[model samples]
Target: MTERACILDTAPDAVGGALPAPAAPAVSSPESAAPAAPRRDMPRERLRTAGASALSDVELLAILLGFGLPGHDVFEVARTLLAQFGSLRAMLDAPPEEFEALRGIGPAKAAMLQAVTELARRALAQALDDKPLVDSPGAVEDYLRLLIGGRPHEVFVCLFLDARHRLIRLEESSRGSLTRMAVYPREIVRRALTLNAASLIVAHNHPSGAVQPSASDRRLTRVLRETLALVEVQLIDHLVIGTRDTFSFARHGWS
Candidate 1:
C-alpha cells in the first residue's frame, strides 16, 4: 500500500456521519436576552449538511482546529498551513516543531496536529500487529512508510515476527545522518534471539525520498540475511522507504 493509503483522518467529520454543530452563543438586546441563533454557511454547518468529504482541505482543517489566534480566523489559519506545506499529506507529515513555528499555530494547535499524525501511525501499527504480515504485504509497506517516510534523518527499523509470521514488535534499531546509517547485523541477531522472534523484516528510510538502495545498503542486507540465517531466524525482507514508494528486496528477488 502507498503512504496515502495509510494516513487516515479520524476526526468525526472525516469518518462517521457529521455531528450537529454546537449552538451559537446567545445574543442579548438592551431589553432582554434572545435564544442562541442557528449557525449558517459555516464549515461545521456545511459538514453537517453535505458531509466531511464535501468540505475542502481547509474546511476540514479548520474544524479539526476549533479556533484561531487573535487577528486570524480558523479558515485563514488552515489556508496558511496548506500554503506553507503545499498539501494536506505534507502538512500532516510535518514535525510538530514545524507547525509550531508557523503563524496562528501555537503550542496547543501544534500538539493537536501532532496527535492526529501519531494516531494514524498507531492505528496502522495495531492492524499490522494483529495479523500475519505475509498475508498482506501491502500493509507492511504502508506501516513502514508512515513510520519513517517523513523523517529528515535516516532511521533503521525492525519488525520482529513470531513463528506464525505475525508481528511481535516494531523497534527503531538505529538512527543516522540524512544519507548514511550504521546498522550492525550482530545486534539485530541478538535482539531477535532476545525477543524469540522467528523472522524479521527490516527497513530504513531515505531522507532524499529515493527508494533505490545504495552499495552499502546492499552489502548490509547480504550480511544481515546470512547472519540471521545462521541463527535460524528468517530475514523475510529489507525495505527501502521513500516519501511515496517502497523498494522491497524480497519482491525484487532479494537482489
Candidate 2:
C-alpha cells in the first residue's frame, strides 16, 4: 500500500520554487526503511487488551483523533486539543468548524470528532425526552445534564407544575450570552399564569462552568419569587447547571 502524503510532501519544492530561497541549517532524518509500529497497536490495542474503561482519556481520545502530523502522533493531537480547549467538554462544546482551524487538524478528523461528540449529545437528549415525569433531584440532574452539561451557550428553562407538582409545561425562559442573560420576572409569572401552573422550577446553564449563583441570579430569583407570590403561583427551585456539577438555590435556602 502507498503511504499517505504528509504536510512536508505537500510543501512547495525547496529548489524548484519561483521565489528566492533563504539559507537554513541542514538537518538529518531517520532511514526510510525503518520498521514502523501500526496505529492499531497503540490505542486500539490498549482498548482491546485493557477494555475501554482501562484506557486513559488521552488514549481514548487519541483513538478518536486517529492520526496526527508527520512528526507528531495521535496522542499529541489529542493533547493539543485538550491544551487548546482546556477540557474534553470544552472541545466538544466549541463552535462548529472552529477546532478544524487548529494546526495539523483537517476536515476528515474534525468531522469525526464533531460527529462522535454530537452523537453522544443527541442520544442523551433523546433518552431524556422519552422519559416519563421527572420529579426527583436525580431526574432533574439527568434532564438538565443532558441539556446543559456540555453546551457552550446559556439556556434557561422553566418546568411548570400543577397543584400536584406534576410537570405540566416545559418551556425555555431565556437564552443569553456567555456571562449574562436577560430575564423579566413579570413575563415569567405571566407565562406561568397562562399555563395554569401552580408552581414552577427554573434552570439555566453556566457556560463558564461555575454553578454558583451570581448577585444577578439572586436578585432575579428574589424578584421572581415576590412577583409569583403576589400572583399565587410558587417558584419551586432555581438550578444552575455547570459542566461537571450543579448548584441548587433551594439547597442553599434561596427558595
Candidate 3:
C-alpha cells in the first residue's frame, strides 16, 4: 500500500486525531478605541501654516506649554490659565509663586513664560534704539506700557533722545509707594546734560488704573519742560500709563 493509505488505516489515539480547528481571532469593541485628532487642527501645525500672529492667545500658550496634565487637554489647560488670570498680560506679569500654583504650570513652564515676556521687552528696547522715537511714537507708547503699566507702585521713566530723536537711553528715575511719587526736574535736566540728549519723553504709571494726569503731574511736566528748554533740550511728551489705557500729553496738548 502507499504510505498515505498506511497512515489512514492506523486510527490510533496516540497519533493526535486531527489538528484542532484554527482558533478565532480576538475582536475589539469600538467603544474602547479612540480616534486620533487630525494633525492639521493641532496648534503647532496651525501656527506653522497660518503664522504665529494668526494664532489666538490660548493657542500660542498651548505651544509653550507643550502638553497638558493627566485629565486635561493642552487647549483646555491654556484656557484655564487665561480664565484664571483674566488675560495673557496678567498671566505673564503674575508672580512666580502664583504662576506655579496654577494647574499644569511648574517651575519650567513659569520660567518659559517669564523669558518670553522679557524677550519681548528687550526686543522693543532694541527696536527703539534702532530708530528715531519721533518716527515711532506708537512704539514708544507700547514700550512704556509693557515696562510700567502693570507695576504695583509708581515709577517714573525717562527716554533720553539724541539730536535726531533716536533713543539714547531709557532710565527709571524714581519709584514710590502705590499712591505717590516725587520727580525732580533739576535732576532730570542734569541727566539730560550728562547723556547729551537733545530731547526727552517722560512717563509714569498709575497702579490705580487712572490714565488722567493729576495736578502734580502737570506741574512736574511744566517744570521739566522749562528746565530742559533752558538747555535747548525739548520735552517731547509725557505719558501716563494705566492698566487699560494711556494718556499722552502730546495728544492732549499738555506738552
Per-model root-mean-square deviation over C-alphas: 11.7, 15.9, 29.6
RMSD versus native structure for model 1: 11.7
Would you list the clashing residue pairs of candidate 3? none
**Local error of candidate 2 at residue 248 (angstroms):** 0.6
Best by TM-score: 3
Of the candidates numbered 1 and 3, which has the greater TM-score value? 3
Sorted on TM-score, highest at the top, how do the candidates line up? Answer: 3, 1, 2
TM-score of 1: 0.76
Clash number for each model: 0, 0, 0
Off by over 4 Å in 3: 1-41, 69-72
User: What is the Å distance of residue 191 in model 2 from its true position?
Assistant: 2.7
Candidate 2 lDDT by residue in tens digits, 1-255: 543211111112111222222223233366532234664366688788889999766778887766576667666677677777776767776765787678767777777777886787666545544344344666767667656766666777888888877777789877776656677677788899898999988888776666666666777778778889999998888888777678888889994
Candidate number achieving the greatest lDDT relative to the actual structure: 1
lDDT of 1 by residue, 149-220 (tens): 877788899999999999888899888876666677788899999999999999988766667777677778
Local distance difference test values of all predictions, in order: 0.78, 0.69, 0.76
Using lDDT as the yardstick, the better of models 1 and 3 is: 1
